[model samples]
Target chain A: MTKNPIVNGKLVCVALNDSEQFNAMQAEFAEAPYKGAPTQPVLYFKPHNTWSTDGAVVEWAEGADSMVVGASLAVVFGKECCRVSQAEALDYVEGYTLVHDFSLVEQNYYRPDIKGKCLDTTAPIGAEVVSIADPQALTVITSVNGTVVNETPVSQLVRGVAELISTISYIMTLQPGDVIAVGFPGQRAPVAKGDNVSSVIDGVTKLNNVLGN
Target chain B: MKHARVLFNGSTLDVTVEDSFSETGQLKSKADGQLINEADVTWLSPIAEPGTIFALGLNYADHAAELAFAPPTEPLVFLKGANTLTGHKENSYRPDNIEFQHYECELVAVIGKEGKNISREDAMDYISGYTVCNDFAIRDYLENYYRPNLRVKSRDSLCPIGPWLIDKDDVGDISDLKLTTHVNGELTQEGTTADIIFDLPFLVEYLSKIMTLKPGDMIATGTPKGLKDMQPGDTVVCEIEKVGALVTNIVSEQEFYGDKY
Candidate 1:
């Protein structure tokens, strides 16, 4: 197994960045607790302890029967970015990699999902970061135990790569090598213990991990 | 002993603070026996490179009630990026468009050991020291999705931590410490660590159960009630008993970054 490409940086993940996911939760968002749709990007952090290399076994939280797993195209920043306009946002991109974002099934969106998303080894990234011509043109496919589960196009994002970096950097500076997972699209594939999950961004990178323990 | 990192003579230096020296205090450089007044040096966050920064929200019953919500059964933990961290005596920008920006006086526990699934009984042994931080929140930017989103809490320089890290041994009982916030030298927010719904040991065990608690990782325990809106030029001091007082100056965006922002 290769070393995780992300060594000394934070993994900032945007929730509900997928258009389908946003639309699906739009009704609930308008109800009490939410009141309205999110004006700014819903952000959360997957700390370093959660980071693992591809092919590593991710242990499930005690008593957790299943988990939601999805593949995201993660943009790695090459420079310290702060307050850059959307037009120039891609210039700071170092390259891209695939990240397996695993989370315990969560129904609440009003509070930060720390316990659900921040479990150790929950996030596994591809070994390499390869430069891409157009991030939005890519398609990510997730396979569970050799069966195709979900295929998502990067263009289906509510906030594209550049816009996410632009808006996030406007609030907090992203250091060199920092990652922004553009977010998974549609519904994620549910995986049980011992299931081998693979996510591939053809010609870019592939991350494969198995659920265990 | 209180450990600190400061900028002196155009270089960063590790120093041991001597609180008994004078009113302004003094620090002795570890490299050499150079003693310098605290006012002459720029204080950096005590931990040079902090790992994951876990911040609790509404961990106090009074604070939970103030927001008109019931005290959370589980700790409302949120992660903060390194960009949000400034140092003692630093300026935290309060955006001109925002109406209510408040300061949260928190007792920050610095993790000294790496562990996972650490039991509450052995949790305190993993702590290296304690510090203080002002977790500034811009109420205007708060959205429901991930309520208290990064925009509202993790803005650049929004979290000011340190002055120094007082070793856990130096501070006797972690609980029962007084946490006070004074804005412009007037006492505004005051509470004791005894009021912390999820105390340090409980938080350590709770967080470590989900993820590995690494050395340099910090947990900013939630503040109590009495949150008051801070304006530009307001000098907010968040002090915890035994741990040092973290002072932050609230500056407007225009003043903090000028037209660059």
Candidate 2:
């Protein structure tokens, strides 16, 4: 059995990196609280406690009726990267994997969704990391109980894989083994207790987890 | 007992701080009992490998009112990455062209035991020790999305924690401890831990119910009112009544990054 690729690193996630999601929320971004679309990447951290390997059982947070599951391509860094250019960003990547990013349903993005997103075992990573020639051309498919519920193309990302590493590395250094989940599509699949959730990065890897409690 | 991690003689060592020390004498290595000079060694955050860093925003009623907002009914919490942490006597950069950057003196509770669904009554049992941190914020990067966004709160070297970790038993009665911040030898911010809207036990219980709390996880229990703008060349000392004082220097981006900026 292959080891979980993100066991030793911190998981940093990008929000609204999907072009479809960014465009869908464009009008709301101009309204009262936001006043404008994000000029830079929206980032959040999935701490170690939230990390789990494939085939794990994830428990629901208290009173949580359902969860929004997002399928994403995980970029594993191989080098200490800081302020690298987009052209050289991919050179620092170790490989790619799949991740099922789970969160409770939230209405607004005004505050950091800690309670909704940082639940234990909510982020299940693929068993192994595999090299891919072009991460931008890949597609992610999420399923519930063996049935496909949502599909998104990596081409729809507002900032491609290389650009995300470049932009984020300029703000904070990315050490070896660090994982970045290059955002998720606007549409996501909802999973309930006792359901099997699986996310796959087309031909690369698959992550499976069972929702419980 | 107070514990610390420091870089002495080109290697990291776990050391314990003695109750009595001269101005120059500081730490004693646990391995060899060798006395080390404070100025000769580089200080590091007490916890060598921290798990998750949870920070609170607007957890103080006075601070919420200072920012012209009502106190949150629920805890306004956020997660910070490890890159933001710097050790005592370190330099936290003041990004160029930013109008407002401030220091937040906060009490940090370090979790010692792994727990899920931890109750408030048992929260005290989970804490291993206490430390002080200066949670700095660059107000210019504030955005509505994730209001206290990572850009503003989690910038590299933005959070400076530790002088040492004091065992909880040594620092009794956390309910009304005094928290203060001094900038350039002038006392500028002051408040009591009693002003914190959501106390430590409440935070531990609330967060653990959402996710498991692992050993080395730290919770920065928010700051109070009296925030003042900090500029380059300012030396800020954040001290809690029983906890140790953590000192940090504010330097310009050029000074912090040197030729890289």
Candidate 3:
């Protein structure tokens, strides 16, 4: 078995306690969200106020509003790419994994854009990462609470995975530590606490976890 | 809950979340290096505020076909503001007379570290975790351009996000994750992570090139097929596999503001 590292950083803040594991990507404070993936590779940053750790827990604010669960595929950057080109983009990838991108939404509240997107314990990523791949021969499956919610072929994506990497390289310089989350299927529904969710890419790896409060 | 800062230390980024930096942590000194504690944090964005927001256009094969366009050759990404995130359990109000709000269940991305142009090789190192979001768009205002702008997509509170963040390492191969959307307990949208036109590694590398992805930035990955309109009083739940779900309610203009007057 290959070594599967969580963050591979030095400073980790989990559950209001604990110490470092692997720090997050640098430049986060200075970066901003894209103005659209290609036209203007923008930058955004979330304060450290956004991290949550180990078996992260989310809530509906105890009936203050509504809630649901989501599952996704994420990529862990092996290295960095700064204004790199398509030709050199492939070399920077570390590989792929899973992430439980969770969030809390109040009906009409929207501010501190980073606050909602950067909530503690709002991000849950998987540990299974394959060291290498050609981008074409991968398979992916999405499930919730033991139910097969979505099934797709890598060949169906609107953009072949590799090209996006190259395009992004042209916009921003890739760094040693970064994450790329592939899009998710559109047919699944929300799961509450006690719901088990799992996903598996046929020739790749599987992401399995349970949703909880 | 703690207040933390994810920033570049020389060339690396570290996440420092204090328990209460916002309301309690006394800024001992005026220097940026004030004795900050993970506690007393007042400046933290509740997992809903993304440093930068990323959205997709017609990534859903079905939605694409409905729009009569070939499946995109690449992911169609767009941007929004951290100011657009709504509370996870609160209610979202539709603009006056706008077509009923439509909810697109999507896989939301959260960066753990900072990366300039992140290569797929070392991409994993940058991630802290992931979450889900209801990429709410005001269909009535969305115009001809495939990319919805202020008229349709960027409405305040149109984006519903929430509850937790899972470390990227804890959840494996995300490509196959699932997404589910519920409108008042009725299943409305069913999708999977497998359909993502741009996989995670590529997204990071591609996105990083376009912009510098900082810790806490939120990416609302493309939504799947089955896009539907939401109405007042309808609760929308966006559930993704592994990642917890985000729930939000829909309200009418009259109900949006309960007598702030």
Candidate 4:
């Protein structure tokens, strides 16, 4: 059973080496943490096991005790980039979507290499993966069961989407449909069984789901 | 009954089971043509610029001895990237000028969450399960460079993974699983997970302190002895005791000539 994740019309993989995300992250580290270079981009890998179709229905895994939710914008890439200029980064983008990368916070975050990402039903994506947009004008809003919790404008990113792509390109090759999940705004408050969590981006669309037992 | 990840028509799948695991015959038949077996097709690598491909060095005492390194005090840890991985049953393509490329067969644990400051008492709960891994490498991918780069490790196809992920819990004691490597039917490397210097839980606690590990992440536990220099046309086979075996071949590196590096 291959986990082929698709959002809009693109396959979900990565355009690695378009190290723009890491570059922006370093720039962010300079001020945010009052630190020096980050040395490395917050690089990540999504094996075939991690993908969920946009808006795919996700159920709690067997023996699962609880649940959690997150609201964020998933920046989707359309073309491959490997050391492209920041200005050219947007050209590789296919579009954007309101992606909900759900996980079990109760699962230890300390073992991300083992537990957090591989839970049988780890990612619960949203439907209506919107294509092409003005990211500058977008605002992401997160709510737990409909009441707003955290909100931020896309422009506030420590590293804009373009800058991050350039940073990542320097390390590895970025393939088409590679997604740049911008960092969480404030905190991704956890959701429990019977709780509903959702999000909406001014231009990216909206996603909603209820934690099931 | 549940969704399991697989590969179909060149893409890995997160498939929902129309049946059950107890129904092995039913599972295989239901997934026969749909689920491509590791030995049946060319396996491409699953990671690209992976934030970090973590490895627990000297897991097997036999491997530690062959390399002339003393057994580690704790898990001997190191990091690799998207370049280190190749697909299961893939062509372990090598550049013409390169020598000393080798294969290490081992178990892999896939992370399902962002782990940090986790304790051993709670570690097992984090791992999804175990799977097969062949950690192939070019002994000297570094040309005197202090740091490793994708250019040396990141060949189009390097690490080959998967027959299917066997749930870690079902694997019983992870530290003692058996594995053997055969080059064209000549058994070379053999060992067990029991030799690992760093067990899974401690590794989780150790890594989370340095960096944030995310879901879908992979950890190559380490390999056993039987290390050998692979040549073109050589068939590299890795067999895990109860788990399935993965067999890949060495291919010619015709594409490297055009690269800028």
Q: What are the per-model DockQ values?
A: 0.83, 0.76, 0.01, 0.05
lDDT of 4 by residue, A1-213 (tens): 214354322112121122343354445445522344433333333333345654444545445565555555666767766666788877777777765555555321111233443343344455554765567567778888678877767676566677776765544456665566654553446766666767788634776766556
- Candidate 2 has which clashing residue pairs, if any? none
lDDT of 3 at A4: 25
Docking class of 2: medium
What total of clashing residue pairs does each candidate reach?
A: 0, 0, 191, 74
Docking class of 4: incorrect
lDDT of 2 by residue, B220-239 (tens): 99999988999999999999
Q: What value does the lDDT take at residue A59 in candidate 3?
A: 30
TM-score, A chain, model 1: 0.95
**Candidate 2 DockQ, CA atoms:** 0.76
* Candidates arranged by DockQ, highest first: 1, 2, 4, 3
Q: Write the per-residue lDDT of candidate 3 for residues B1-261, one digit (tens) a residue.
A: 222222222221123333343476342322354564423332222463356567777776767776577887866666654435664576677756655567888877688887767898877777777767777776554432223543355544667665346556656678888888888898988888787777777778876654457777666777877767877878888888877667787887567655520
Fnat of all models, as shown:
0.91, 0.77, 0.00, 0.03
lDDT (Cα, tens digit) per residue for candidate 1, span B1-261: 999899998999999987675565778999997888877899999998799999999999899999998999889888888888889899999888778999999999999998988999999899999999889999999888787788888888999999889999999897799989999999999999898999988998888878888999999999999989988889999989888788899888878776657
* Model 2: how far residue A110 lies from native, Å: 1.0
What are the per-residue Cα lDDT tens digits for candidate 4 across B1-261? 222344556755444333343454222323443543323333334332233466665677778888797887755554444544555566666766866888878777777666656777777777776667777767765322112233444444466766555566556677667888899889888787777667788888766543446665677788877789888888988878655576787776653223522
| Residue A20 miss distance in model 4 (angstroms) | 24
Which wins on DockQ, candidate 2 or candidate 4? 2
Q: What is the lDDT of residue B12 in candidate 4?
A: 54
**Every candidate's lDDT:** 0.88, 0.88, 0.54, 0.58
Q: What clash pairs does model 1 have?
A: none
* lDDT tens digits by residue: candidate 2, A52-134: 88998876767977788887999998888877899999999999998778889866788999888898778888889889989
Q: Which segments of model 2 are wrong by more than 4 Å?
A: A1-5, B22-24
